[model samples]
Target: MAAWPWKSLARSRQPTDGGDSAAPGKLSLSLSELFVVGTWFGVATGLLELGGTLAAVKLMGRVTYDTLRTNWHYFWMTPLSNLVLFSVSALVLCVATARIPRLRTGRVVFFLYAYLTAWSLVSAIPTLHKTAEVVLAIGLACVTTKFLTKRRSTFLRIAPRAAILGAGLILAIAGVDVYSTNRPVDRGPSVASVAAVGPPNVVLIVLDTVRADSLTPYGAERDTTPNLARLAREGVLFKHARSTAPWTLPSHASLFTGRWPFELSADVGRPLDSAFPTLAEQLADRGYATGGFVANTQNCNAWYGLDRGFDHYEDFYENATVTPIEVLRSSRLGRYVVTSKLAQAVIKRAAAPVDFRYRKTAGMINRDALAWLSDKGDQPFFMFLNYFDVHDPYQPPKEAERRFTKAGGEAQSAANLARDAYDDCLVYLDSQIGRLLAELESRGKLQNTLVIVTSDHGEGFGEHGLAGHGVSLYRSELHIPLMLVHPTRTPAGTVVSEPVSLRDVAPTILDLLDLGTAPTFAGKSLANTWSASAADRDFSEPVLSEVDRADHVPAEVEDAPARRGRMRSITANGRTYILNGDGREELYDLHDDPEESNDLADLADAQEHLHQLRELMEQVTGVQENGE
Candidate 1:
């Protein structure tokens, strides 16, 4: 009868394996005994990996369980999972290697199997690539078993110990990383101390990726934003407004903190740093209930730390529930099988008939906003709402889609299709805006609430070789609509053409509410514009927009020596100067070439303007003029 592997390991009293001892004088383990030790090594390595991650997260602090659950797929619950997987892989490899009668031969095969299995399990995709990796692992295991089966007593005993020691060193390094990560600083006031009384409600609506030119108020050929036009009729519109960055996250960070986008740490996978004070924190400290409802999951999700200081932050994925079994599923071999190309094709074919409706649409967001407003109970509120309908891959409702597309339209160009879809989304968003305003008016909340509508950035449709934002500092991505409506309606329909930065939004909100600006704010308050004499008003401060090319790079290249090339655009004195990372410059006369089709960088007459804008860029970023 065959002896159980563990029992065999226990009965072996002397070092019989044909190798030297792990230490100089210790007895060398036999084949079966070595199997037990190898299994321990694998399990220990796995446990250390998983434990380290958990410890790191705990040390970081301020992370809620819901946030962990929402972001769990990013890690696949790696700690306990690694232990289980490594233990099983070790046991299976040992059993297969045991077929070789020679302890020395079996040891070599076992180590090879272990190495291959571990490498195969490392993955960045849950697709055919994973299947290929697992197949390669199994192939290596089979070959190791077949070719290295000759039984011999002469083998080096030190190899196994060396590998085990290497793993231990790796685990120690991982532990250091966990303990060394910087803890986020606590900045805001405690929720318990917040008073329920002072300041009028402030509503900041960010129209994600919507360019100023797309709106009717900005002279678009299409009536893309009639509701926005209506707001413009009763509010102040700034025609030359610009975003701080050509993307959602950094630009929004600038809006919230009233700082330049360059001042914030930009990492899509992580939350915003807790060191900066947010506008919500400012308001909450002065007795305002702050809430945020955003549709952009990539940058605005609560996991990203943008939810700081808000009394309530609603993200579509926040309520998703993850079971313990679901956490373990990613570590299983069945995951590879289920994610195989054949299985995926079958699933896609089967599910083709089911229409998937987007959960984070403008209507759904407005519904939640209305519900939140109903429950506030007269406490002054600060609300931030972001509508992502105008962003890329724009798919509006069927009615809107049909209206934008021809009734029986033949094949259209990609640009036309994109444009139509974009316009349709704007129209749909406009309707939702109308609904939101009507609700506020009906509830009599409009009379006393200050409303500000703007965008984080704009979208591009293949202009300057870019279809989306974050790649360039073009006007298409920087130019955004900014409209402000006062509660008392003193300066109705005033148009401010001087270039203004999105960073100004926070200071303006505070200024309008009679709240003194926080010392940390870097933006100038536009509240003075209402009362400042025309000559005293300073439009000389350049509106700066920046772009980080690193943010636009694909995830596959993340390990590449982070080549973070940054670009800055300066709009001042009716001219726009875009300083490229490679020291190239593009100058556009905003009045003569709003489309930016003509670049006057080489024009001799424009040299002084270029030099001035270049200096302004350097002053803003604190980087030298030579692309330092």
Candidate 2:
């Protein structure tokens, strides 16, 4: 019926005279020439795929150019990684062909090159139909193979030059990226001079995704945070501190600006707007050296506007120092291959020794912060540290894990194992905190520093049928641990039982430092709560927490009430009123049901309280229930 595709190559491979020229309609290549051509072809394919993926991601508006530039290493790393992968593949094919006389026809090599290139290009186009992608890839491969056969000499002649140019371009880009990202920080001249004896150096440490109930200070059975317990004993601990939101970005934004989450422009895929001045910005304006050391690069990076006022900001790089596997993950082809379960397992095992941790651990963050601290001159400083080890995908160090979990704990149910791993992470994080505090004390900075420790938001582990933050506005996610340690201002063993929102953090910090509040700050300062006598304490402001509609809904909760719209809760007078998105309301008495197991929304006696809460929410937020 039909002749095999490689028959044409077989006819063309007949013995050639001892020169580069081949007979008309016939092709011949020495082993060296075959390898060079194949390698160049592979390199070209890689360049095409790289360009296509970048263009597609850009066109979809998923990330900004500034983000790519700030993280520029990935830009050059991906192409170089692709080049190595494709070149090795070509070399292997050439060697196999040389070993087998029957494979010398070159049709198999040409088809593979065309197919691989076609597949890469197709994959780069996001949301394309799977069936169409396969059909297009195969059709393109056939056409490419035919063209390569007909113009074999032209392709062979041009490949080496192209490969050299491509290689040079990648190197040039790499040089530029490295230089730009590593430029020295811009520490502008002090705008305002400080007094000889100014306020204590402010060190705000945020334990990300840590629930109040998980720590010993909040009555946890286990001593997951002995250092925090010590701090609570020596500092002013807010017993009912609540986050303004249940997620990282908004909660952090509120913490910095002393404003509600909806009042700011921080949301999914949107960076915090620079409308309101941040605590660091205000502190820097008053001549404080500000530095931010964060382990959660995904949400806490400079690209997200969290680094607006910091003179020095350290974040985790995608590939701190290049390793082959990290480079592979940066490429389009490697990403596709790793989608297969078997490939993922193999790659995970291979990459364990090199890049096992998803983000920088608490110890690494401490190391960088300590280094920065040691380098500071005599300026009063504002140091913000974010520890992210307790966030998710909990994988604690072996030593720390052993303290909380057994060796064969993976055999437990997924939820139980996750909780165990979470506790293990907390143990590791607490140890790091203890180490940091000890180091600071040794350096003579602890006594003079105002150490304010808290969490951005709490985590959810089967609480209210939720397993993560950002999906619900329950106590498990909103309640956070807040404590401030100062040698003179805060007395040891002081605890405030009044409910407070994280929105008050910035104002309180400014208030404590004797700096005037910005005009745009919404929350009242809590300085009086800790500093004033018990009879003068005023923490009457209602605490409000809001969670916007989720950008993505997990399949398990597709039909849940949380998928309806935004949710808001108001906590006051030891009572909580939840206004759910689907027009449902829930009320809980904190004194009777701390776990919120019982709801009093439908109780006739609670109707007046619900009405009062709704009125309070409307008055505070200036929005009615009907969205008027």
Candidate 3:
């Protein structure tokens, strides 16, 4: 082979006062050689840390955090970030030693790198206590550095070869990761027996974490969702739509399967199982092409089993494709650096266009969706789009922020600021929705399409002492907007006031399409309420919302009434009865006390209503008073 690329670096030597560089006690290395060695060592250490962490996560099967997921982008980003960091550190060390004659930069830098590498490797062993791991790493690194320094020539001989091997391995792994993640999803065979013809295409858009009351169509004073208001005017809006759960997975599970939350495998740590067929599966089986594009990658991704039946599903960092910033966000070190307070401050500055989080914007999602729609042929398609911008850590675009919220100042409380930002996000989401609708109209697809706009669940902004979803079954978290728009089918401007669960979404879609109800679905078709020609128009029905104690609740408040155990509620006859996890019962007249401040559980007149609701709940959910 041609001479090794690092031959000069390996042979390079430094002169000392004794002049004989080969002297046993006077081992020295040139600044350039030291620079190369230290930089490579740092890069190798980073790669080792990342590889070890990934291997541990895969082998253990317990580290299931979204960040640790094996996204292809992380492979390249983590090692690259480490390389940059280590190279810069090496440069700094080399410059310092050249300037300050007394500083033994080579040994100090090598020792520091060894210690850090050891620490990183040990940290991958999740079973070890952090203190013990650190101590062991330091001890090991000290011994290793001492041994190598004593045999500098031997170490120099091996270092270059080891670094080259490491570089090769990194490239190999990166290539493999890219190939694996980007490979086409094998959609074995088309389930459709015949191509769909006249049935209206279904476009279900879920505005995640959007509460009904916050939208202008739901009586909010602000015009935050003018587009939604227009859609409401052109569609049938369910004024009292409620989600079956207070969070994403379960609520979405209910929406897709037409079943209750307790009946599904979806939970804080678990994903929806195949026990129930999704709406997409039902449509796909009946000659409809299905596609799901979701921005809530944390829970709505394929990892969570939400992409079960879709021929194509797109989520954040999918297909081994990612932007530069997305790659940074996917890496462990880059995640820490990008999410640091200083970096966040810089990103959130008014002049900066950077997003605080690595979420796809609604515009981006819409563009992808529209492109997919363009490719769809004569086969009626069922498309599911989830917009996550309205969820947490609200950072709205500059224009929307200016339009909705007052300038950030000391006068605005934290809650006010958060709510304002949330509204800003809603406005941005609405604008995107408007754009999607306009695109559909321009393409002559709007008239033949059945557009459904709703949410998985609502967000809680200090309502009923709840700040976010999944913590409680309060109205703030359960009440979501539901609207259906179809040119020739659904009656425009029709407002249905009856309480309905999101479970009805699947059944209603099937019912309107004349597909009938699936055997497993527990929800009733909502067509009866909107279709005048139907025999039974009575819309009165009990709506149930359930929530299990979420894992994110702090330990200090684990026993808090709202955060304890499982909570369930049933709304019927304009009254809602809540069975709290702590064995407390609450009853509220939703018509008169929509705020749920007045508890009628102990009232003599309310006992009869509570008893009836308890029976209804037990009959519907098969769970008794003590929450079996």
lDDT against the true structure, each candidate: 0.68, 0.76, 0.75
Q: How do the residues 1-628 of candidate 1 rate in per-residue lDDT, one tens digit apiece?
A: 1124324433544344444543221243355545544545454444443444344434443333223333223243343344344545556655664654343334343444444344434332223475566555555544543433322232234445644565555455545544543344333332222222345788899999999999999989988888999888787889999999888878988899988877886455445786789999999998888889888866776666688889988874322323333333334332443356775677588665322223367887887777666667567889899998888778875554445756544488777888888898998999999999987776667777889999999977777656666667888888999999964643887888888899888988888888888878878887656557898876465588877656455553333111247677899988999877666798999999988989999999999999988888888888786744
lDDT of 3 by residue, 283-393 (tens): 999988899988887777665667888998887544346555555555444565667888778767845667444667788789878767665656688999999988887
Ranking by lDDT: 2, 3, 1
Residue 193, model 2, lDDT: 32
Query: How many steric clashes between backbone atoms does each model show?
Result: 3, 0, 0
Clash count for candidate 1 is: 3
TM-score, one value per model = 0.70, 0.77, 0.74
Model 3 TM-score, 2 decimals: 0.74
lDDT of 2 by residue, 476-548 (tens): 9889999988887677898888899999988888877778777778788877787777888776887999988
Candidate 3: list runs displaced more than 4 Å: 1-72, 79-199, 273-275, 284-289, 317-329, 334-356, 392-394, 407-421, 520-522, 531-542, 554-561
Lowest lDDT 10-mer window, candidate 3?
Answer: 1-10
Question: Which runs in model 2 stand beyond 4 Å of their true positions?
Answer: 1-72, 89-163, 172-199, 317-319, 338-359, 404-421, 532-542, 549-553, 556-561, 626-628
Q: What local lDDT does model 3 show for residue 468?
A: 73
Which sequence of candidate numbers ranks them by TM-score, best first? 2, 3, 1
